[model samples]
Target: MEEIYAKFVSQKISKTRWRPVPSGSLQPAETFATGSWDNEENRVLLWSTGDLGNLDSDGGFEGDHQLLCGIRHHGDVMDLQFFDQERIVAASSTGCVTVFLHHPNNQTLSVSQQWTTAHFHTGPGSPSCSTAPCTGVVCNSPEIVTVGEDGRINLFRVDHKEAVRTIGLVTECHSTVWIDIPTSSTL
Candidate 1:
């Protein structure tokens, strides 16, 4: 039989990703990340489903998912992706991108790097700058790519504070972005 568990978080969840497990490892994925949207205060959170091996009399796992740690996020959390086992990358509606580091020793999350105003829009004859919402983010370890409502794509390195490259799609806007990594070469 299958089992299902649900939790009522006050805010609407925007994204969720399971922490990647290493190959040849006997351990299963016990943790995941979550991002929230349309709330007074948005957040990026880590949760643990507890030990799945510990089953109760009904053959269901004991306990619900527990919040491990969380951090406040600027604007709505538009997109979220796990960079690796210990790092999470998040794109926000405020046109900013952030990388959060998870410390297992303390069970805490912290901002490791951020790019402010990574995407923006300017109106004709308007002196003020408006921030564009970063709609999606994808990660390939050190490289992260983000797409925004302003029809712009930005490529960033996790260790750097500035974007490595930017591509503007003048006539189009995007809501999601993805990455494809080549595993082998064809002769």
Candidate 2:
């Protein structure tokens, strides 16, 4: 027989991803991350499913998924992706992108970098700007790509505070992918 477990988190979950287990390791995935949306205050949270292989007196899994750590998010968590074992990248509805670093030793999460108002819209003759929702994000080690409702795509390097490049005027850019060519160009 197979077993299943569930938890009732107060906020609606928008996205979730399992932490990648190191290669050649004997353990199953024990950690995961979650992003919440439509709440008074949004957040990115880490959870741990303790000892799946351990059985209780009743022959059930040992413990439920326990909260490891969490941090407040500026807007609705539009998308979430694990940049690496210790880093998490989140896109926001406020047109901001943030990278969070997880400290396993202390069980803490901290803001590593952030790009505020990375996406926005401006009318042809208007001097004011409106922020657009960043709908999606993808990561390739130190490089991250974000797409927004403003039809803009931005490429960022984790160590830099500013965007490396921006591709504007795309139509409904909800997601993106990196393509490497033989000639040393990425599309």
Which has the greatest TM-score?
A: 1
TM-score to native of every candidate shown? 0.86, 0.86
lDDT of 2: 0.86
Candidate 2 lDDT by residue in tens digits, 1-187? 9877888889889999888777667777889999999999999999999977687899867876889999999999988988889999999988999999999999999999999988888888634888888888888877898988888889999999899999988765444433332232234
Each candidate's lDDT (Cα)? 0.86, 0.86
Candidate 1: Cα lDDT at 82:
89
Candidate 1 has its poorest 10 consecutive residues by lDDT at: 178-187
Tell me the RMSD of model 1 versus the true structure.
3.5
Q: What is the lDDT of candidate 1?
A: 0.86
Score candidate 2 by TM-score against the native: 0.86
